[model samples]
Target: MSKTVFITGTSSGIGRETALYFSENRWNVIATMRHPESRKTGLEGRKNIDVIHLDVLDPDSIQQAVTHALTTYGSIDAVVNNAGYAAFGPFEASTPEAVRRQFHTNVEGLMDVTRALIPVFRRQGHGTIVNVTSMAGRMTFPLYSLYNSTKWAVEGFSEAVAFELRPFNIKVKIIEPGIINTSFYDRSKDVLSTKEITAYDTLVEKIIRYEEGNIKKGKFSPPSVVARTIYKAATDGSWKLRYHTGKYSGTILGLRRVLPERTFIGMMRYLTLR
Candidate 1:
């Protein structure tokens, strides 16, 4: 029998690609997003795909979507918690509300969705939880302190839960992707307003320019790269905890692991502080 996988944030990017990938590979896909009406990723009418409305910030909606998937698909074998937003700016420039929204969507929201599936998976005796974290989760960058906090929390959370869920045969898989060519650089951006603090302006501008240059040069990988990695994590049947995907993730993470802390930070500074 073909397995079923529930995915969030399917309106675009990695989530959409992953949904399509799984559907093409003969898996039932619950492709969910805030507005399923849009059909932006064009999953409608596709084989083995069900579009769902899910706002990660809404707990009720999370449960509702989970219920819908289970009722429609009969069983869910894996869930991809890809519904998250990013907030970028200096930490000092971040507002209380911004921080709350950031953590609520990326951290709390992911937790809520996962919590909903735990019981279902427990009943089934096996399941996979795939979290799409970033390379920033392990390594920091300028002007991404708020975003960094959420991803780091996810890494820690996933790691702790992975150990806890081992007895139940539940798997927690983390996907750490480097910058991918997604609206994350555009539509999904939540840049903190820096009008009050002019101190970090020069550094922030430098970093933005450096990043824009990379995007212009096509250095980032596409969403399909991440989708492929996610598919591997879900179907590979390994208890592996982390799968680094997308461009430059392995290189950057490997360097951070072997290099001294100060040296790694220095290298990061050199890249954007120019």
Candidate 2:
């Protein structure tokens, strides 16, 4: 029987790309999203792909999607937790609700999904959990404190969990992508704002403008690169845990590892805030 993979956040971006890649490669794909109805026509024609409703924020949906996928394919070889968005801008301006929601979706939601599927993985005695974190998880940038925090959480969580899951024949992998050219910049990001506080306005504007310029220049890699990396993580049949993708992901991470803490911080401030 062909292997099956269950993925979340397939409405667009990395998740959509991953689903398509796996499907084209002949793996059965459980492509899930909050609005699966909207995707019916597009993915329904594909024999090996099943589009289903699964909002990470909804525990019921999580259980439902997992159950359906297992029954449909008889086995789930992997689960890709790729459903997350960013809450950007200055931290001080971020609302309490926004902060909570950010963690709810990025950190807590991913945790819930993993928790729901571990039993199935244990029963089968083997499975893979691929988390789509970000380069920001390891390195910080201006105006993305909260989003960075969530990715860091995922990174730390995955790293620690890998050791525990090792004996269970389950593997955890983290995919870190840097500056991917997805709808993420325009549609999937939320910028925090304090209506009356203008202290960080000019600085935030400059940072946003700089990022937009980089994206417009096509400096970021396409989501397919990350999808390919994810596929490798799924099928590599090794205990490897981290896969970095997109442009400058390795270089930035390498520099951060080798450079002095103060030197790196100073360099980032000069490049972004200057």
Candidate 3:
């Protein structure tokens, strides 16, 4: 029987690419997103793929999606937690509501999805969990306080859970992708701001200009790169924990580890504002 993968946030970007990749590789794919009837990803009507509605913020939807996948496929080999959004800008500029939403969607949502699938995975006696985080999980940049915190939370959570899940023949993998060319650069990004906060305007402007300059020069990898990496992580069958993908992921991770804290902060400031 063909292996099955349940992936969240499959409406576009890495999620959509991963769903397609799995389908092409002959794996049954449960490609779920918040809006199934409103997406243009063409995941629907594809062989070996089922597009379903799954909003990470909706607990009932998470359960329903998992149930549907298990019912249709008998067992799921892996679950990819790819549903998340980023809130960027100064910490002070981020409203309490935005902060809550960021953590709820990126951190709690991932946990909720994983929690729902753990029982099924435990019952099946084997499974893989691939969490889609960003390089920001380990390496922080300016104007992404909330976003970085959320990814970092996923990183820590995945690391800690891997130990417990290993005995059940389940593997937890973290996909730390670097800058990728996707809707995340625009549509998926929430630029946090309030009318009262003009203090961060200059700093945020500098960071945005610097980042945009690099983006225009094509310094990022395509979403397919991360998708392919995810496929490898899910099927590698090793206890390996972290899989870095996309442009500059490995290099940046290395820098973050070896550089002094003060020096690293300076370097990031230079790279993000220069």
| Per-residue lDDT of model 3, residues 1-274, tens digit only | 8999999999989999999999999999999999998787888898899999999999999999988998898999999999888888889887889999999999999999999999999999999999999889998888888999999999999999998999999999999999888888789999876568888888888988877887999998999999999999999888899999999899989888999988888988787776
TM-score of each: 0.98, 0.97, 0.98
lDDT of 1: 0.92
Model 2, 1-274: lDDT tens per residue? 7889999998888998999999989999999999876655366668899899999999999999999988888889999999999998888899999999999999999999999999999999999999999989999999889999999999999999999999999999999998898878878898786577899889888898889788778889999999999999999998998888999899888889999999999988997777
Q: Model 3: residues >4 Å from true position, as ranges?
A: none
- Model 2 clashing residue pairs (backbone): none
| lDDT by residue for model 1 (1-274), tens | 9899999999989999999999999999999899887666689888799988999999889999989988887899999999887888888998999999999999999999999999999999999999999998999988888889999999999999999898999999999999899889889989899999999899888988988999989999999999999999999999999999989999999999999999999998887787
Clashes of each: 0, 0, 0
Comparing 1 and 3 on lDDT, the stronger one: 1
Candidate lDDT scores, in order, read 0.92, 0.91, 0.92
Worst 10 residues of 1 by lDDT: 38-47
